[model samples]
Target: MENMLVTRFGHAAVLVETEDARVLLDPGVFSVDEVFELERLDAIVVTHQHPDHLDRSRADALLARNRGALLLADPQTVEQLGAPWRAHRDGDRATFGSTTIAAVGELHAEIAPQLPRVSNVGVLVRSETGPTIFHPGDSYATVPADVDVLALPLSAPWAKVSETIAFAQQVAPAIAFPIHDRTISDAAYDIYWNHVANFGGVADLRRLGQTEATQV
Candidate 1:
């Protein structure tokens, strides 16, 4: 569907588009620098406050350019980022033109016992007559229902390959793509990609490179 365009900007940054709305998710530090250059945006969704998950400068640039764009995030992120945002916790839903976003998940995955756990809310975005996609931020929690596409985080401080595989197996979406993957080198990233591609996966594994969009 023309409205269901999903572009991966590396790491966890994703740009989701509909006929009437354009939503950017997690314009983090590791995300492509071009995210700051977006001309039009309907909303920006920050799953958490981590620098690698929420880059304030890019967000500022985007919001500054599109004054009416909404910034949606969890309470902690809205508080920590100190930006004008709407509090979107689990079960809360909002509409942006022709698209709808449903908040999901809660806390981020644990980095360590000594480290503090932060709030992270996954989002389910659905556009008019297009695919429904879920971006789960830094968590491995499964969505309650299967989706058309899933942004699967393949690497992070708080998860393992086995856990990633298990999460995919559980969610069992029609298509799953890698995200949260800037920490690894190209070769190392390939290893993870190969595993996800070749494993006895329930969902169709897809690797969306930087700035690449695929129809789900």
Candidate 2:
């Protein structure tokens, strides 16, 4: 078993690479540029149909480039995007070469009471040798199990500082880092970090910026 490489493309998109597989998760608007640079992928997983998580044109472009890559997403998203893709619910699991991806959770956190809630699936990717990595999409849904590397969200319309910190502590991953933070200002980021660092007791919280990677 070889180590898996986790690379962030800012916002919700991430590239999880193992010796034999390369998986791209949520290649949305914020990550389209980074996604465009990739030459090949084994799979592309989308959490939902939100523009921020699934940019239609860019995703199509990616699939066009790599004809063999598979597209995996929740049922709602699959309905919206349509065909040639796998629909994963809360408990579905799929394997591609050396990597296994499990879909967790079903609904996106509420942006507001009046706004329609969309489907969102937090992805848990594991391999034989590397640390398990969980990207919880846009929801602070329960972590199905302990992970080695948790991609925690720092800021979003549906999240707050306290809730995000609590989520991290609850998941209790061996190492936690931030994602879904493209909307905040520099000052807001400082505030989020302050609270998260102070209240995220016992969890090894690492501040990972856009396009950053943490050794697994």
TM-score against native, each model: 0.93, 0.93
Q: Please provide the root mean square deviation of candidate 1 (C-alpha atoms, Å).
A: 1.6
Clash-forming residue pairs, model 1: none
Top candidate, metric lDDT: 1
Q: Residues 1-216, candidate 2: write the lDDT tens digits.
A: 228777888788888887778888888888738775676888889988888788887776688887888789989988876888889889888887667888899999999999999888889998866778899989997666768788888889999888998888888887877788888887678888878788876357778767887666
Steric clash count of candidate 2: 0
User: With candidate 1 superimposed using the best TM-score fit, by how many Å does residue 124's alpha carbon deviate from the native?
Assistant: 0.4
- Which digits, one per residue and each the tens of the lDDT, describe model 1 over residues 91-143? 99889766799999899999999999999999999876877889999998646
lDDT of 1 at 12: 93
Give the 10-residue window scoring lowest on summed lDDT in candidate 1: 195-204
- Model 1 bad stretches (over 4 Å): 1-3, 200-203
Candidate 2: C-alpha lDDT? 0.82
List residue ranges in candidate 2 displaced over 4 A.
none
